[model samples]
Target chain A: MTYCVAMRVDEGLVFLSDTRTNAGVDHVSAARKMAVFEQPGDRVLVLLAAGNLALTQAVMQLLSEPAPEDKPTLYNVATMAEAARLVGDAVREVHRRDAATLAEFSVDFNCSFILGGQIRGANTRLFMIYSAGNFVESSQVSPYFQIGESKYGKPIIDRVVTPSTPLDEVAKCALVSMDSTLRSNLSVGLPLDLLVYEKDALQVTRFSTIDNDNHYFQMIHRTWGERLRQIFGEIPNPTWADPANVPLRARETVSNVPRVTGSELRAEPDTSAPPFQTLMQPESGQSQH
Target chain B: MTYCVAMRVDEGLVFLSDTRTNAGVDHVSAARKMAVFEQPGDRVLVLLAAGNLALTQAVMQLLSEPAPEDKPTLYNVATMAEAARLVGDAVREVHRRDAATLAEFSVDFNCSFILGGQIRGANTRLFMIYSAGNFVESSQVSPYFQIGESKYGKPIIDRVVTPSTPLDEVAKCALVSMDSTLRSNLSVGLPLDLLVYEKDALQVTRFSTIDNDNHYFQMIHRTWGERLRQIFGEIPNPTWADPANVPLRARETVSNVPRVTGSELRAEPDTSAPPFQTLMQPESGQSQH
Candidate 1:
């Protein structure tokens, strides 16, 4: 398991990936999942990968070699779309070479990548490449892509980020997202590789390798939880006292009892009975009463 | 699909379940996923279920009826463990009656439950019963059990609740957790059932079927996000300027260039190269520079 996320905001792009890889719990190890193709003054491409380590490594190797004949390589792709296509094609190449052998072992050839960066003359872009080598680009409505163990970290991003978010803010959001993922999931571990690409910079300018000790990340890990708990504490406990709480009204209407004490009677409503009394049991099973 | 969570806390127990059930995205409808078996001052068992609606409903039917011969029904179960085992046995009974037919249609015999309450003499307990007729009890260290679409809502519970948490606060935490699940997953939806059990009171005293118009819940849905985004915005953005961020130092140590421009040479440990620079590609592919 892995967790990688990339955001394309108005000012730039932000990428973060966890380094832990494991064939199983016993085989856990650290492997850098971020690859920076920094071609200063021309283009900057950031690739964050997750899934089978061997498969990702093989795809990366294939990406580095020359593409057949005039096909574009990552280093020379003129547009971000073409660059995304180049990645999908490389994934397809690895699938063609390895999928059958992997199937023999019952491993589903699972691998995914988040590719995001800028090509000079084009706006920053983000794309998520799938195991099947098909891909989807990020849009203004959803200007981000997450691959692997995504849900635990997603709500924060959904609430905090948008296309116009500042580049540095996006980076912070990514780290907070990663913090949630790391705490909830054992498969995604540190040190993390983080890269913040300024829009149109055409270079890898802001990058960090955040380990457990990185001061800012440590601060994030501590403060985010403390603040969350503080916020959680401040939210009022849900009140059953409110009239809009139907079950309370139903209980009132159904005399003083909280139990429906009969099976499926709500479907055949008694005008005298409340609108909802759903917890059901057979009348014979009322001995405890 | 559904989301049901039960927590055992120092004050008592908390149960919350979303009513939405779906055959697929197109076939969504609402069904109650929570069942309350209150024997007044004797026992108050709450069952929260998720997975195949048919399987869960069938299991519920089996649980509602008398067990064959002298076997105890949930109404007669002497302990919370016995109640959990009864639930599991009921699940296996459903599987026996339906699994083969379901398999013919390629549907898994999937269903699970969180059973929690107090049985007069015992302390408040929570157990998760799985599809295979086995169950595990929650402990003081991990006081909650969530079934179906659990991950999206787990991190918050992990951070906020404990066995020592107050019952009302646990209820609030459960709702907040459900809010996260409902926002991140479409399968978990509105009109939630929330039941708060007091330690030795045993009868269902606080229960609410919370819907869209429920004032407290509407406040939660609005305030949780606003406060989260406020808290998120308050956190400082990550800085690559921090020297503790190794990638920044690596660039300084490896001359002014940001690209490594060659294959996996970091292993050779050029003392000149700052300890970690694993992103690699062939030297021949440096044309973009």
Candidate 2:
């Protein structure tokens, strides 16, 4: 499993990925998931891959083959959208060749990619390419796309990132999101690839391979959790001690009584019968009343 | 879809569940995911369910049947473990009756449950029951269980909760976890059912059906996100402008260069090539060198 996230913000695009892969829990290894195609002044394309390593690596090999004059390649694609379509074609090409054989062994031809960068004529762009060889581009309304183990890291990005977020802040948010994923899931391990592209620069300016020692990531891991606990403490616990006076208590009639079957409990909670128990005796009959 | 979580702390047990159910994204409604069987002084059993609503509702219907003198039922179970076995039996019973029928329509016989409460003679115990009617009990090492749309809400609980956490604080953590889930997943919504049981009181004490209007839950929904974003701002962005002076930069030789295919890019990075472009012209050739 892996976690790859990329966002297209006003300033530029941000891409981050983790490098852990596993055959099962026992056979885990580190594999870089980022591919950079920099024509410096002309274009800077960052491709992040996830899913079956063999399939993705195969696609990478095919994409690396010298461009034929008859068709388009990542190097000569006219637009970000064209680069995406070429990636989709490559995925379909791989599926046609290897999927059926892998299917005999019960392996699905699964892979996905995030292609984002600037081409000479266009602004920064991002697209998520799918296993089915279809792709979707990022828009102002939805500024990001995440593939692979995405849920744990999603809320932070959902709350903080937007098309207008500054490039540096968006990069910070990606690392923070990755921090959550790393903490919740061991399968998505570290030594991360981070690339921040500046709009129209058409070159990679900020890139880092973050591992156990990357201080920014280290600070995020340590401080985010600590500060989270601090705020949790600061938020007053729902005052359940005295429901009658506690504003946070559900003051309405206790209509949400959990479905009580045909036990002695009831069709309705006798709210007035016994609101709570302070102490109990073995012979307490009203306790069950 | 639903989100239900249960934790056994030293003070007692905490259970929180969301009530949203959807057949697909188009058809959505609310239904209780929690059931309580309390013979008060004798025992207090709470069941939280997730998965195909039809299947879980069937399990609930089966569990609600009148207890016969010939066999054990939730109403008469002597121990918390026995109660869990009874719930498992109920799940298997439902599967035997409906799984094949559901499969005819390509519907999965999917359902899981978290059961936590106290039977008079025992201390509080928690169990997570799987679709196969198999189950595992919570231990001091793991102290909690969550079923359904659980990932978005997991990291906070992983960081904060423990067996020694106070009952109120544990309940607060459960709400916070649910808050994260609600924000991230539309499938898991409110109003929520929360129940907190005391270690020896052996009866329901703190229970709330928190909805959009519930102030405490509203606070958690509002404040948790706001504070999270606030703290996100406080965390310094990774300094990437000048890697030469930044301690956090990956100073050691970066053996982790992403697999570059056969483009003009070479096997070795020309480290001496001009790094990071501040300004560039269309004729900049070294930018790609």
lDDT of 2 by residue, A26-64 (tens): 999988899988776778899999999999999888787
Worst 10 residues of 1 chain B by lDDT: B280-289
| Model 1 CA lDDT for position B244 | 28
- Give a tens-digit lDDT track for model 1, residues B1-289: 7888988888999889899998889999998888887766677888888999989989888777644546677676789998899899889889889999999999999999999988888898899999998999998888889999998899999999988888888988888899999998998898888887889987777776777756667778899999999999888765434232333343233222234352332123222322222222122122111
Q: Write the per-residue lDDT of candidate 1 for residues A163-220, one digit (tens) a residue.
A: 8889888888999999999999999998888877878777666666667556677888
State how far residue A90 of model 2 sits from its true place (Å). Answer: 0.5
Candidate topping lDDT: 2
- lDDT, candidate 1, at A27: 90
Query: Which residues of candidate 2, in runs, are more than 4 Å off?
Result: A241-251, A259-261, A264-273, A276-289, B241-251, B255-289
Q: How well is each residue in B1-289 modelled by candidate 2, as lDDT tens digits?
A: 8899999999899888998999889999999999988766777889999999988998988788755566777777778889888889999999999989999999898999999888887788899999999999999989999999999989989999988988888988999999889888899998888888888886677677777766677777899999999999998766644433323222434623463533433433334332542211112221321
